[model samples]
Target: MAEHVTPPGIDIGTMHPARRYDYLLGGKDNFEADRASAETLLKFFPATRINALENRRFLRRAVTFLAREAGLRQFLDIGSGLPTAPNVHEVAQGIAPQSRVVYVDNDPIVLVHARALLTSTAEGATAYVDADLRDPARILTHPDLLGTLDLTRPVGLMLVAVMHFFPDALKPYEIVDRLVRAMPSGSYLAMSHGTFDYLTPAKRAELDALLARSGEPAAPRGRAEFARFLDGLELCEPGIVPVSEWRADDEPEPRPDPAEAAVYGAVARIP
Candidate 1:
């Protein structure tokens, strides 16, 4: 892994979402800027680390369900953070070695680690697209993505823990709609998003003010608002719920409280 290698043109002083997420997940691929930002965020959202773990667990369960149960052979993982163990391709290909995955992220460091991620099972394939989630057109039309996976067939579209950064003002719903429109009827969308729905009004206000002051773009939404991204889709059992509770059999006992994590997760099939 070339994680220690600083990719050219990356700003080491600024904290990036991918690096901050890696920091939150107890990964050493982050710099001082990312750790500092995570510490500041932890001041308000004290359960930041637990939330990261719960969200990661949700991703594993959701991807396993998509690959093993839903029988999805191709995956498009938008906003895939720094290379982590049991990545989307690893999880999917483990269940079905023929599965193909295309990971999307604009982080330069993640792009550098693309070599490690691109290594797949002999029967499976993996590709990386160094693109921003904000640009749906670019992602949907990327040559790497097109070459790796066929959109006309069923695909497991993963937007896990990513949409919250894109507030309503960014036309997040429209971005999702465009991506969903390209998928076939049998395709599935699995996502997990940060939420303020479980928090007290005062706590939400404090977190909101803190983020505004810190210039963090995180916009935690309510369950209903988050579900808007899956509108017109067939919701899987256990419909939108706390990340820790979404198909949590694989998780150990003593799951974190929804109020503590405050992140919603769900998987819906495109009809």
Candidate 2:
């Protein structure tokens, strides 16, 4: 682990909903409040862990593709949760030793863990920014990010399993638009979002209520709505699809499960 340098007045003891997500993922860095909230979430959606894992797998695959196939070397990972296995930097740098990565998140807990666990590869670079997604300008102009990446060139913008945190009121689409505008042409936006397309109306209602009680905003959108986020962008081959079915590994196909994990994965390039 690296050194822990938390921003001023940031406390990890008091739990937040995102922290609870870290707890539910079997991480040891979350507080009691987060644990309680995670328990409540699990009671309503028992497949929450599976959903999270699948989303994470999607993130890894996207990063790998960007580095190995797309010839991209810089990455901006917004709403980065607590550092987990095969993080963006790890996957990208593993493919190309010169890859550079900048992780952005407002959670102090995530900051602490990111500083302690996310290390820059000897041939590359990695840094953490204590910022929120709502402040895209702050993220795009922050000294840490500017110093780490070159905005004049193409960079991969990863928003894995995080946009759902922002509701319609926050103008999540506009936020994405701003970031897209900031990046140069050929930049990629890889996103994995949660949706209720797979759930029954009653079950969706039950989960929505549970999230409200847990202080989380549910932003499950249909394919059309999700596609709007990439309105001016060029979607990569295989457009948006179920995460499990997105470029699945080359091996004997496993039996398909009927239960869908309310999540969609897609990668698009700015024109």
The candidate that wins on TM-score is: 1
Clashing pairs in 1: none
lDDT of 2 by residue, 1-271 (tens): 2344546665655656566666766777666667776777678878777777677778888998889889999999998888988899999988998999999998877787799899988999999999989999999999999999999999999988888777999999999999999999989999988878878889988987876775667678877888888898899977888776666675236712324456888999988
Cα error of candidate 1 at position 245, Å: 0.4
Any idea what lDDT model 1 has?
0.90
The candidate that achieves the highest lDDT relative to the unseen native structure: 1
Off by over 4 Å in 1: 1-3
Q: What is the lDDT of residue 240 in candidate 2?
A: 88
Provide TM-scores for the models.
0.97, 0.92
Lowest lDDT block of 10, candidate 2:
251-260
Per residue, candidate 1 scores C-alpha lDDT tens digits across 1-271 of 2356687979989999999999999888888899999998898879999999888888889999999999999999999998887798889989999999999999888898776656899999999998988899899999999999998899999999999999778889999999999899899999999988988999989988988887877788888899899899999999999988999976788889999778999999999
